[model samples]
Target: MNSLVLVLVAIVFFIVAYSTYGSWLCKKWGIDPKRPTPAHTRTDGVDYVPAKAPVLLGHHFSSIAGAGPIVGPIAAAVFGWLPVMLWIIIGSIFFGGVHDMGALFASIRHDGKSIGEVIHVNMGDTGKKLFSWFAWLSLLLVIAAFTSICAATFVKVPSAATSSLLFILLAIIFGFLVYRRGAGLGISSVIGVALLFFCIWLGLEFPLHLSYNTWVVILLAYIAVASVTPVWILLQPRDYLNSFLLYAMLLGGVLGVLIKHPKIQLPAVTSFNLGNYKLLFPILFVTVACGAISGFHSLVGSGTTSKQLDNEKDVKVIGYGSMLIEGVLATLAIITAAYIGQDKLAELLKGSATNVFSNGLGEFMTGFGLPFATGKSFVALAISAFALTSLDTATRLGRFIFQEMFDKRKSADEVSSNPLTNKYVATIITVVLGGLLTFKGWRTIWPVFGSANQLLAALALLSLAVFLKRQGKEYRMASIPTVFMFLVTLFALVLLIIGKMSNFGKNWPIILIAVVLFVLAIILMITGVKALSDNKVSEDKNFKA
Candidate 1:
């Protein structure tokens, strides 16, 4: 077997081990699935009720598994596959997994409030405010990124864009039927997958021609509605459908590599050079988040997900398992593109890696009884649909974090607490901002998000480390990985900032944005020092049902 096949096999084994062992640990922790979640316990029932396990996982995965995982790994593959591969495995196992699991466990134990709430309660008001800024900014970057990626893909592939529109409509129809209509998950999932494939077929048979502006309008409208809808309605159903697409892409991508048997073969390691922008450890870390550790995981873990825990024991699966799936996805992407030839990858996938991914997957799926044209088109549209779904979720999450950041400056009525209102305003603001900024033809803006995201990763990891420290028994055991990842991420982000600053110079729109973030990152890091010495803290609950 080639290196790609071996790497894939190893990833599969690790995922199984982690999920199974993590589940076992949950039972060992005495987590109970029977008790009401904090959302339900604290709910007036309009919203904030605890979710079913699958539903919660769907929300979490959809929110966190955005273009980051797809884009980060692919872009960082420039640093050669070894470092990316190493980080993906080690980070998921020790760093990212731990960060995600820790945030989740902490939030659940505290109540289904956000990480911001937990920060205030345990780390103090100052810590909460600073971390909240990091959280909101991190999510905003997500909105800009995934939105741009989707917009670009829609513009490039009109047929796929139309297919995506159909699939999303189908997702909503089934979402309402299965979730809102009390139809079973199994039935809904099956039907949802079927509809997606049919849309793919339809796209091939009769391509729709949507202009770039027209598609953007459609994308924005879909996001506005989907963001506020209940998890069961749009988020869960669509994500469930998207998950199958992702899996098919994964399977097909792997098969393509196997059939092609190409290799990166670009030498075991490449030198760290980006001209005068020396890419030391910092650049490596910041530019390569999802493959390694991402701060964004904390938001999702603490956001809608913690409310839906079937049992405290399931964190490993939802948190760690979802990340593992992403890692596998990234690895497959690496093999597919690298094996195909890097120059061709840069040519074909340039600015539209999702298209190349879907294209490759389409070719692979064609052998599985799917028509060639239909499969290729299906592959493109499936990714676009997923990206659009993530754009909506990320916007809502950003809005939630933004509004929740500061102390109440006004009465509750004065504040916009309605998710619908918040989502609409947030999406418009971000899309408008993103559209305006990139309209100047900027690739620099793209990496600003990467830097900001890595900084967020540092903050979330620090919080996770703090949580572990407070757990007396677990503290000692967790300290090593916590400290190691903390330092590595910190170093990586610093490099990202330096690179951005150097790359953009004084007129650097994105560099200025990133520098501000780096300062905030430092302040938050200082806040951690205070958290360490300030022994007076809230009661950290046992995360059992």
Candidate 2:
């Protein structure tokens, strides 16, 4: 199969799905344009500030995109492109779209509370606490994994490190201009994006070199500050501006494929099993997370995006729309591996999936007259920037989850006598724990992270289903995905634990963590079942809101 034709077909299918199926979902759930969102209702200058549709989409998309789409698809390519492609398309439309959209909708209706709060409403305080602990732990894994990935990338391509830092300073200035000085979004965005490209060039000219360990510490420190600062100053503007890099990368990749028309060199089906440790069923679903559905997306939807949402009408575009866009990126990633063939991909995997993806994208850019070295560097910079975005965002979400464990009704900035409830204390504690795991490196954390991430999606879906049931809304869309993800994640976790047990002394910590996660999943399942069995519909006046 030709890469161009395959990509074009996927793009067309996504557009159709967005228009037809996505719209149908919007109608079924009743999106009210007139409804004032939590961003307006909460009106906190820090996290709850209302953002324009485009800007919010940028933050949401950048945070969720990270390296998952690139890394997961490329890593999972051993199963062959055909199965991976089918899952990306099918999963995004039905599974991921529904999961993301539902979480956003549920959070907005719950006064922009996290998913833990959603569970609190339908289930009880105990369920809320359990879910919050589970979520915070999962986020720690996210922070550690992305931090290691970004730091290593910085060591590999020092130019990306330079550009990434420049991107942050630019975001701060952009935020000040647009928010403080009351500049227009239109002109500011035009100038911001233009300057962003220039930064990429400057990065290439003057690369910043740092050791891997040094880079990890610096990245951790950066996220610590990024998580605590006001969103507009750093998180929002940086992610918003950085999203353009991703957009350009996507456009270049598509155009390159169109011009090059590379043949898919990998077989359509490799085997159901890759080795003694790998299998097709659960592993594929767990590995290809962000491109399809991720539990992490639910945290993002509820934690930050829900607070920044300007209107309920933008939900479909920012929520479901972003997932579809990522699906396209993931498709391109798998194509890169397929184009390289199995043996070459194996060699690339020995180094990193980011290498495989960037090189593939770099080669594609050559078809459009860009030098491979420059294009490769550009692609490298883009992924590293997004990885940094995810690192900080995960830290922020971790802070939110930890603080919410004590109190869900109030924002982190609100006054609380308990030291644990203080935002500063919460942020520090979260970062320290996540940072401790960072030294362990992403390679060790990634397997368990994948399983934990998918389990999170399952749990989030279950919570959404319970919320919908209480409101007497159509919920099979959420419930069906919940069941499927639960099966996939549970099986994957059990297998992972069993596999690790062979090296009991070396892998005991991982086994312990995985075992705890398994217990959490079982407990959440019981709680969700009880909630679903309840015949009493919630009469909360907010449901109508």
Candidate 3:
């Protein structure tokens, strides 16, 4: 099979799905453009400022796109391209798109509060508290793991470090120009993107070198400030400009595939077992993680994206559209592994999934007149940039969840004067804890991130379904996806617990955390189901699912 053909087919599938299925979802859920979004209703210039569709899309996409799609798909290629590709395509269109869009819609309807608050309204305070703890902890793992990952990347390729810093400064300038000085997004974006590429080039000329530990400290400090700062000044604009890097990389990868027309060299199906005790079913789904669906996307959607949404009409495009784009990126990622064949993939995996993707993508770009070394470096820098984006965004989200936990069902703008609810204090607390875990080693924290992350998706789906049911909206779309994710994550967590029990002494903390998450999921599931069962909605309209 030609890789280019696969790319073309996936693109068509996404476009059609977005136009038809995605649109149908919005209509069924009753998206009203006339209804003021939370951003407009609660404009604070901090987290609740209304954003143009393009800028919000960029921020939302950048926050969620991170290394997950690239790393997860490439790593899961162990199950072979057939299963990985199948899951990415099918899962994204139905599971991920609906989950992402639904979470965003649910949050906006609740005045842009998180899924936790949605749970509060529908399922009760107990479910809300549990979900908040679970979500905040999961995001802590995200901050820890991505912090370490980004730091290691900086230490390995100092040029990425230089460019990443330059990117931040560039975002600040762009934000000020567009927001403060009334510069138009069009002209500013053109200049901003031009400067973005310049940062990459300059990074190559003057690479910044720092120790791994030093880079870790610097990154922790960066996120501490970045997460607490207003959205427009840094987070939103940085993400907006950084999105162009991703767009460029995607364009390069797609054009390169077209020009090279590489054959899919890997076998369509490796054995289901892969010679490990891990079965193909749950492990494959878990390993693919964000490539197919992720719980973390719900956090990004409801946590940040919903707050900045300008209009209800943009929900489908920003929420569902971004997920489909991620699906395509995941498809392209798996294609990188497939094009390289199993032997090379195994070798590259020995280093990192990032290596496999960069090397493979670099080779692809050579067909388009790019030097392999430069192209490889460019790909590496782009990955690091995105990983950094996810890092700070996770930190900010952790802050939101933490503050919300103390707010007692209040909307985002109505936090009390409790010391714990202070944004700066919350951000510092989140970053400090994450930094401690980073020092402990991302390798230790990462083992359970997948299960915890997917579990989050299950919980978010549960919350969304319950919210929709309580509101007399069509929720069957969330039903199967909800049940499926719950099954997958629970299965994965159980397997993880049993496996970790072998090394009980060293792995007790992980076991304990997993057990807590497992119990939380069970409790939340029961609560959500009970809430739905108790609802008085007509059986004909809402009970069929």
Q: What lDDT would each prediction earn against the true structure? A: 0.64, 0.91, 0.89
TM-score of model 2 (CA atoms): 0.98
TM-score of each: 0.87, 0.98, 0.96
Best by lDDT: 2
Off by over 4 Å in 1: 1-4, 16-35, 43-49, 211-214, 258-260, 278-280, 349-351, 362-375, 406-442, 476-507, 540-545
Clashing pairs in 2: none
Instruction: TM-score for candidate 1, please give it.
Output: 0.87
lDDT tens digits by residue: candidate 2, 1-545: 89987898889989999999899888878788888899998897999999999999999999999999898888888898988999999999999988999899999999998999999988888889899999999998999999999998999999999999999999999999998999999999999999999999999999999999999889878888888899989988999999999999999999999999899999998999987568998999899888798999999999999999998999999999999999999999999999989889999888799999999999999998999999999999999999999889999999888887876345546677778877889989998888888887887888899999999999999999999888888889888988999999999999899899989998887798899999999999999989988886886786672
Q: Model 2 segments beyond 4 Å from truth?
A: 408-414
lDDT of 3 at 525: 91
Question: Residue 13 CA error for candidate 1 (Å)?
Answer: 4.6
Root-mean-square deviation (CA) per prediction? 3.6, 1.4, 2.8
lDDT of 1 by residue, 183-291 (tens): 8877767777787788876766666776655655666566656656666556666776776777777677666656655545543356667554546365556556765
lDDT of 3 by residue, 1-545 (tens): 89998899889999999999999998889988888888988889999989999999999999999998988888788888999999999999999999999999988888888899888878889999999999998898888889888887888788999999999999999999999999999999999999999999999999999999999999999999998899999999999999988988899998999999899999898878864357787888878888878888999998899999998899999999999999989988999999989888888877678778888889999998999999988998999999999999999999999988887534535647789988889998999988887875655666588889988999999888887787788889998899999998899889889888988998887798899999989999999899877765433231212
lDDT of 3: 0.89
